[model samples]
Target: MPDLLETVIENRWMVQPNHANNLDTAHGGNVMKWMDEAGAMSAMHFTGETCVTAHMDEVNFKQPIPVGDIALVKSYVYRAGEHSVRVRTRVFRENPGKTETELTTESYMIFVAIDEDRNTTSVPELTVGSERGERLREEALSDAP
Candidate 1:
């Protein structure tokens, strides 16, 4: 079994003109789409089954991403239950000159595993096999908002 931290999934989307709002920054809707996709991947990795978004705790846009910037979206399963998986996601702006990545957005999402019949299904217990995985789970629990 892989650790939850090792199960992290990431996707990158270039900020295009169509994805931007009137201000020329990446639109909130587009960001949400990226977050949803990345978070779903993480949930699927943890559950080994298809999942649907049960709830979005909160999406905080800390900084604006420009049209030319690349949005690096990363997600990992932080906690899991019988049918629900909690995922933590972060969006970063890719900048070559910066030594540190700039966090643009973050959110906590909950997904419910589903069977082929469209009914909720049980998932395996989350194994925090590594120290990093345990740390992330603790952080997720501590930071409710």
Candidate 2:
């Protein structure tokens, strides 16, 4: 069993000029890419096998991450089926100097565990290791809108 909390991952990407759009903010594709990477990492952590995106819930872009901002991407495994793991991923626009942050994107991703032969494999069951883990799981599920 893999604890949900143990699969959590957080990553930050600086919005470089090349990654910006004509609006001088991070491109939507870039944000999605970051989210996918974070989500995939969480899935891999939970499954202990190569995980690939099987499906993704609709993404809602709430805000833009402007140039010079940090895209803070966080992901965690909330639940898992026999062969697929569901991960919640979110990106926030962060101003490190001022310590301000705002939600930019939220999405749920599903990844299927695969073996070297590209065959689907069974993933570890999601286990609740602590009270905090259970609370976080519930919070994420309820907060997802």
Candidate 3:
């Protein structure tokens, strides 16, 4: 079994002119693509198999990340079913040299493990190895609809 925390993934993207919209803020589509990729990574890491995104829950753009800011995407697997992994993904706006980050977008995504044949396959059970892992799982569960 893989610990839930072991599946956590964090990636950062600098919001540049190409990623910006007319308002000079990060485009919604770009943000969504980043989130989806991060969530898929988490799921694949946990399952030890190729994962394909099956569904995405309600996603809200809470704030706009302006150009020159960094889009920090974080994702972790919180739950797993027979062949599916549920991941919670969040995007934050971070400025260089700043210790604090602001929430920009959030969503829950589900991915199905896939075998070499591209057929859905079973996934191993997820475990919480430490207090932080337990807490993270709880927090995601509480946030669920």
Candidate 4:
């Protein structure tokens, strides 16, 4: 069994001019790519196998992260089926100097584990082994689409 909390991963990407859209904010595609990478990492870490994205739930851009801001992406495995892992990923706009952060985008991603032969493989069950893990799972469930 894999503990859900152990699958958590976080990454920070500086929103640069190259990542900006015409609005001078992070592009939606770039944000989604970051979220996907984070989510895939969580899934792969949990399953100890190569994981590829199978599906993505509807994503929402609640706020735009302007250039010079940090896009903080966090991901964790909340649930697992026989061969698929469900990951919850969220991006926040962060101002490091002021220590401020706000939600920018969120979505659930599903990934399927694969083996060296490129075949789907069974994954270990996910378990919530601590209070914090339980709380995080609950939060993801509540925010699910």
Candidate 5:
């Protein structure tokens, strides 16, 4: 079994001019790319197999992260089927000088485990190893619209 908490991942990236658009904010595509990478890591951690994205929910961009801000991406596996992992991923904007962060984007992503031959494989059964893990799973489930 794979512990859901153990598969949670958080990463930070500094937004630079290259990642911004004419409005001087992080491009939507770049933000999604970061989310995908983080989500894939969570899925791989839970499956212990090579995983590729199967689908992604429509992304809702609520805020813009300015070029000087830092993008904080967090991803975690909340549920799993026989061969697919469901991950909840969220991105936030963090100003370098402030501790608070604002939600910028959120979406759910599905990843399928695959072998070297690209055949789908079984994913480890998911288990909540701690109270926190269970709470996160509930949160993810309840937040779906």
Candidate 6:
């Protein structure tokens, strides 16, 4: 089994003008798109097969990403079942020097692996093979303020 930390994926996207809404901030839809993509990447890393989103537990937008800012999205598999993997994703804004990071959004997504025929397939048990993996899993389960 691969360690969740090793399987963690990070995706960065520039908040482009076209991706913004009338408010000049990144559109909520664009943010959700990036989150889903990042989460799917993490799920595929853990399952080693194509995975589809079964559910999105919650998505809270606590802050807005501006056009000149960069959105850094990180995702990792925190828990896995027979055919499902629960992934936690966090999005942050990156600005040089300032080094400020705000948890703009977070989501807990469930994905199920699928075979070539598009049938759900069982995935291997997840193991926190490293201290970092264990820490990430613990963080994922922690209550959000």
lDDT of each: 0.88, 0.92, 0.97, 0.96, 0.96, 0.88
Model 6 ranges off by over 4 Å: 96-98
Q: Which candidate would rank higher by lDDT, 5 or 6?
A: 5
Model 3 ranges off by over 4 Å: none
* Worst 10-residue lDDT window, candidate 2: 136-145
* TM-score of model 6 (CA atoms): 0.94
| lDDT comparing candidate 2 with the true structure | 0.92
Stretches of model 1 off by over 4 angstroms after superposition:
96-99
Q: Write the per-residue lDDT of candidate 1 for residues 9-101, one digit (tens) a residue.
A: 989887999999999999999999999999999998888889999999778999999988889998998888878988998999875445567
lDDT of 5 by residue, 20-135 (tens): 99999999999999999999999999999999999999999999999999999999999999999999999999999899999999999999999999999999889997999999
lDDT of 6 by residue, 1-64 (tens): 8678866999988888998999898999999999999999999998999999999877889999
The most accurate candidate by lDDT is 3
Worst 10 residues of 4 by lDDT: 95-104
Q: Name the better of 2 and 4 by TM-score.
A: 4
Q: What is the lDDT of candidate 3?
A: 0.97
Report lDDT (Cα) of residue 51, candidate 1. Answer: 94
Report model 2's TM-score to 2 decimal places. 0.95
Whichever of 3 and 4 has more lDDT, that candidate is 3
Q: Best candidate, TM-score-wise?
A: 3
